[model samples]
Target chain A: MQAFDHHTPQTLPEALALLAQHDGTARVIAGGTDLMLYMKSGKAEPETIVNIKKLQPLQGISATNAGDLRLGALVTLRELTRSPLVLESYPSVAHAAGFMASEQIRSFATVGGNLCNASPSADLAPPLIARSASAHIVSADGEREIPLEDFFRGPGESALHAGELLQAINIPPPKGNAVYIKHAPRAFMDIAVVGVAARLELAAGRCRTASILLGAVAPTPLRARQAEAALAGQSLTDDIIANAARIASEECAPIDDIRGSAWYRRRMVGVLTRRALTALSNAQPLHAR
Target chain B: MAKILVSLSVNGDPHELYLDTRRTLLDVLRDELGLLGTHRGCDAGDCGACTVHVDGLPMTSCLLLAADYHGAQITTVEGVLDDGKPNSLQQALVEKGGIQCGFCTPGFVMNGLALLSEKPRPTEAETRAWLSGNLCRCTGYVKIVDAVMTAARQSP
Candidate 1:
């Protein structure tokens, strides 16, 4: 990496102050998996690195009083996968976390860093978006929250300002069965070609609500609103699921990349979306299963 | 630039040094501390050649800034040895013919030792998945997986 002043701040306020003092020339280092590589390649050459790893407030995984999952910004992917609350209540999140880079990378790669890096193929984005998660951002001035879907502006771009930091991700209580499927050549250590996440709330054998999100095929993890509309209030039959999947495939604007061709990603999106919905439809009721 | 003071315990030894903040833990281990067991393969964290246990969990040390790991417990492949002797996993790897080029051995040892510590009894598929990050370019994965399984079976 390039030569830079590394600041390990013990408190979030101290970290925020350091960031503010540096103006726009500093970058916050979370896991540093991507940042270090970028710095080495000169893709990102910040004058200062604010290490927030020691901030205690951004390091917990707990359920709020209302039963929503509150995941701190610094929670590693391994911790997310192993959290009882995540594995039980948000299996899709755990599944996504489990499918990321590898055991070594997962040990330190933070969910916050993954989102802030804003990789189009980030595994956690689709699942968290499907669960209607929100980003809790903290700044020296104050704090603000926004829907996770709005957090990404493009590949490697986020809604965060120069001085703001993502503090935590708040996931509301799940109301249905969910699944996150990542299509990669290898089961591990490979980025996704086409990632899909689906959550369906069923009542009286009809779909009461549907949330479908796609990754790797768009500038950001995209909510397939058209496909979701097709599933809402409709019985998730083979034909409806297939139609929704087809619509989802068309909704994304994928680019031909090394992992896969745009055509291949589009085709895989339909297949994976159908697979996710079919599996969710066949699964037992949320509480029972 | 002024060097930052970093204090940490590595391989059961405590060290305090003033080092350039740009140096990674992998660089510090290999160059400053003379811990050559932790090899540097892809420095970009793609190859787990520099895998080490930071605070009891396997992590890619190549990406960790040495200055950020103050007061942390770091365990490299050398640290996993059983009183200067090969641990069960190391012994099993040798017996199972898991060594070809031997360049990836330290990473495999660190990662395998972690797996054995977490799950003493792991299935073949589990073993394969756990060692997925540490790539043996020789593609001698079957014996590596076998060695990890053998070590688990031989334990207790």
Candidate 2:
């Protein structure tokens, strides 16, 4: 690892100031799980590290006045998996959190870092997007909220400015059932080949709204808008679900990687999408192994 | 980078030392504190060979900067010993023949001890899920799971 100045800021303003003073050369580290890997590999060599672990505002999990699930930036993946509120309200999010790397890594890996890192295969991205979540970003200038779907610009890139800090992620109260399926060779400590999340709002045995999101098959978590449109206001029959799955598989832009080939990922996306829809249609239990 | 003075409690011992900013907690434990029981496998977080209890939760020490955990309570593999003797988990591992190369033992012990402390009698599936982070290439992990199960049963 490269040598750098470490700054433990007690306040978010102080942390933002350090980032601004460094002029985009400083990095904010909470868990340092992903940042440490990047630093060790020389992929990231920040001149200053703004440690935000001490900032109180970036901690805890709560519900907004409007019943939205508000997860602070520093809330670790372990906390997400254990929070009863999260498990009850957003089982898909909890499942995705627990389905990540490993027990040790999840013990310290934060939700903010997970989204800010902007990995296409990030477990939290697809579920949050499917739930219509938004990100709250703060800086010395002030704070602003943006749709979570717009947060990811590319791989390892986010909408955050140089000095901006991700405050929290807010998801509206559950209006539908959401399921996230990660297609990976190993159940634990492995990245996904193709991940799919389906959120459906059904009324009178017909779908009123559908949100379909795919991961690791694009530069960012891609929402299959066309597939979602196909499911809208339609009966979720086996044939209809299969048609929507075919449409989703055709729309994502996957690449050949060591984990899997693009062809395999595309095929798995179809299979996983069909499974997710089938599970949701049957009103099966949220827990999926 | 310049060295910074950091204070942390390791194995119930408090100490302050001047360390470079790049030195990880694993380096501080193995090189600075001379606690060699915490092995360093993958410098990355993939391998849990450098696992330790940071404030009672198992974390990969190699990825943690010592400076970042100034006032943290750290429990290494050595810290779990009862009066300089192997604890129930260690004894169970030995009796169950869970050791082969022994490189991944300290990590497995640290991780398993934390799990056992939380859930004294975790099921086989729970044990497998909790220890998934620590990889033991040898013994095929059968004896390890058995050892944890035995320790859970023997724990008071």
- Top model by lDDT, which number? 2
Chain B TM-score of model 1, please?
A: 0.97
TM-scores for chain A, candidates in order? 0.97, 0.98
lDDT score at residue B146, model 2, on the 0-100 scale: 98
How well docked is model 2, in DockQ terms? 0.81
Which lDDT tens digits does candidate 1 get at residues B98-152?
A: 9898989899999999999999999898888889999898856999999999999
Backbone-clash count (model 1): 0
Q: What is candidate 1's DockQ?
A: 0.80
TM-score of chain A of 1: 0.97
DockQ of each: 0.80, 0.81
Give the DockQ-based CAPRI class for model 2: high
Candidate 1, pairs of clashing residues: none
Give the alpha-carbon lDDT of every model.
0.91, 0.92
Best DockQ among the predictions, by candidate number: 2
A23-95 per-residue lDDT for model 2 (tens digits) = 7888988999999888889999887888889999889999889989899999999999999989988999999
> Least accurate stretch of 10 residues (summed lDDT) in model 1 chain B?
B75-84
